[model samples]
Target: MSTKTVAGNYFEDFTIGQEIVHATPRTVTEGDIALYTALYGSRFAATSAATFAESMGLERMPVDSLLAFHLVFGKTVPDISLNAVANLGYAGGVFGVPLYPGDTVTTTSTVIGLKENSNGRSGVVYVRSVGTNQKGEMVLDYIRWVMVNKGNLDAPAPEIVIPDLPGAVAAEDLKVPYDLAGRDYDTVLAGSPYLWDDYEVGERIDHVDGMTIEEAEHMLATRLYQNTAKVHFNQHAQAQAKIGRRLIYGGHIISLARALTFNGLANGQSIAAINAGAHANPTFAGDTVYAWSEVLERIELPGRTDIGALRLRTVATKDLPCADFPYRGEDGKYLPQVVLDLDYTVLIPRR
Candidate 1:
């Protein structure tokens, strides 16, 4: 089986109830760990330093959950969203077990439902995806929906049905890391004035800064996420393998997008629900990441009125902000340098 990529739109080409297995089985590495620490400044002991991890009773540092999620999601892009219109939403997500640096990740999705847009040019598809380690243990599972263009709207619909998904995971379903039961609170490393308190629903934040990635930077990230297909690392692989020249780490884009949300959505620092998210395009080194956000909906949790939920979008770019960064072009294609567009629910303190 050749590993050639899917082209044009994925919509008109898809069949309902079909199970699509995405290409790319990647193995994570230590280089990925170093890059994540330098970029995000996440000091969670389980992921940051080896000594800290063992002190907490773990054999070694584990990978970030965010990193694992993105790797699993990226593998599915070619087959699932090659012709997607826009992502609709997400739900039913659960992270089962922690992933180590050496674990290889591969993903598969089941098409759960389909809905046709009234205009006939586009329709919606829902897929349930699960990520598995090399040992074949399930690490994560989630459902996501995307708007995909129909190859032929005239093609008769197989079934006009949409699967039901929950808006948020029950508190009981959250899998807070066992080793992360306590925190030392290194304010210097965390880089923020806000904490569990001092946030308000509807408030927004802009994390005013940008960084340019290099070919080496993104490859390190992809490898850390254990997405080590030759295309991401070996420049020789690109010429010989025919993959793109530089593979940017998907997490770098995620960090930039999340950081950008700080300006308006900073108050929602404690993320309660992931809701759903996406990497709209492939990012390469030399891309300048920028970010901004809007508060979508607010919800108050029981006995936790001090914090509320805020849904937001974080986008990244290549050079500067694209006049239209995330939208499709007149040719109906994604603009270059717009690496990611993600929607998620975060926790903020009550004003």
Candidate 2:
């Protein structure tokens, strides 16, 4: 056996306040955009057509927000969640400068909290990760916590520290990086008549489409992100496990849900912030995924009249349609079929 091979980090190896600079800085390219579209079938005009993006006041066709997110999030897997049991949730995610083709992104993380599970075999580890472009400007900043396994079961558990995370990203702190001022947005080309002002709080839309995930496709998507999470790829190691199958990467579901939103959210082109998110259940190959969204708030940006923000909660389900909006039980627990609960904000042109 080669001792130089990476064994990955476990629960016992983490400590509060530890800083980790993840490896593999990836440069965004048109190929990545193409593959992302091929995978998720995203049809938003701003990212799909260069001329449309240019007319919208962007310097160039920008990378899809979630694609940029996965690329940066992938870099942290080797050091942060290789032995993860599950990715719990996300919060305070703000997209900064737009990610354009040819821009390179790197990531870094700091451990802020840790707790050993009562069973002593696993514990939750919380980290805040920041992704930056070649110009040293932030592309994305967010916090996420994962349940990780213990390599040394007998190792003494560290002092439990659960970091205080925000319930949501404040509207005022959101960065509106692109200038849509005075730009003529074509609702005809956008594919949706509804704009920011058209939506009222508490409105729910069921995205009436579903995509069945294939094993090979999920593997391809995982490889595209360069995500090296063991549970996603190690089939030989999973044969004896409880699920007995390769776990679908959670990010895959997020992208699928985002792509489905295009039917109703076509004019909601740009994702400005991810207020909060959670992978409620494990997703696997062969699960047919469905999605739906609710308008949580309609926020007006200070001094900006051309655009408005919509705080939305998008829910994803596996092998279950969202026409009835399958979400939680009266006891306040995520339904067994639900896979993702994502709270985010999108920037839409005002009519």
Candidate 3:
């Protein structure tokens, strides 16, 4: 037998402090921006119009933050999560600089924690990954943990190590582009008149729109990111599993929810940071995704009167409308219809 074929890494394969430089550096382009917009219908003015972005002091429209996130995340899949059963959660994610079309992105990850499941059939691997541009400027940094399947059920468990992670990124550390400060923003062109001052803490906005997920669209988006997780593909193999269907990548749901928020939050132009996120439930093709957002906190940036930040909790529900803000049960368990619960910071114009 040829020894060239390689099986992907499992729980037993990772060690504390191992560094992995991911493959396939990707250069963002106009084509990716167009395709992503078509896939999710994202309409933030800063990402959609060059003229609008220039009005806000950017030379050109930058790619959507989520698109940059997906591209960087895709590079880590082949090396980190090829055999993952599930991606658990993310924390302390920060975007350093806006990624322009011509910028090339590469990624590296460090294994920071590990824990064997009581069943001994699986384990969780925690890694902190950083994506940097060609100039070696860090574009994004975050910590994520995944549940990976074990190739050998009888393999001895690794030492349990769980790194201490912050529950959220502090407001003072949120990064805003240098050019974006002190610029007069246009709400009329931005689509929504609601500004940072308009949103009050504890206010909820039902996006009042839904998008049906198509198998082809999800698969294309996944491939565009170059994410090769088997559960997201290989329907025949998935049919034999518990869910019995290919899983939609959680990032897909996040982008969809973020896009849907445009109806009520169009003026919230840039994603300053991702505090935390979770895929509470799995979503499959044909499910109509709905979203709603609650304002968690309002922040004022020192010396900048043109912009402010809103800590928003955006939730995605599959086949469930957000009119009632569907979420966890009284027992603190996610309802079956809830697919995503994302907490992130958005920088919006100050009226």
Off by over 4 Å in 1: 1-9, 34-46, 53-59, 85-89, 117-122, 135-137, 149-154, 180-203, 211-253, 259-273, 277-289, 292-351
TM-scores, in order shown?
0.61, 0.98, 0.97
Between candidates 1 and 3, which one is better according to lDDT?
3
TM-score of 2: 0.98
Model 2, range 233-346, lDDT digits (tens) per residue? Answer: 899777766757888988899999999999899888878888899999998888999999999999998888888899999999999899976599999999999999999999
Question: Where in model 2 is the C-alpha error above 4 Å?
Answer: none
Report the lDDT tens digits of candidate 3 across residue range 1-351. 998976778999999999999989999999999999999999999999999988888778889999999999999998888888889889999988899999999999999999999999999999999999999998899999999999999899998999998776776788887355656777889997788899899999999999999999999999999999988977876777665888899899999999999989998898988899999998989999999999999999877787899999999999989997759999999999999999999988786
Model 1 residue 311 CA deviation in Å = 8.3
Candidate scoring better on TM-score of 1 and 2: 2
Clashes of each: 19, 0, 0
Q: Which ten residues in a row have the lowest lDDT in candidate 1?
A: 179-188
Residue-level lDDT of model 1, residues 54-137, one tens digit each, is 544457777766767777777776677645544555677776567788998889999988888888888888899998999898
Q: Which order, best to worst by lDDT?
A: 2, 3, 1
* TM-score ranking, high to low: 2, 3, 1
Clash pairs (backbone) in predicted model 3: none
For each candidate, C-alpha RMSD in Å?
Answer: 7.2, 1.0, 1.3
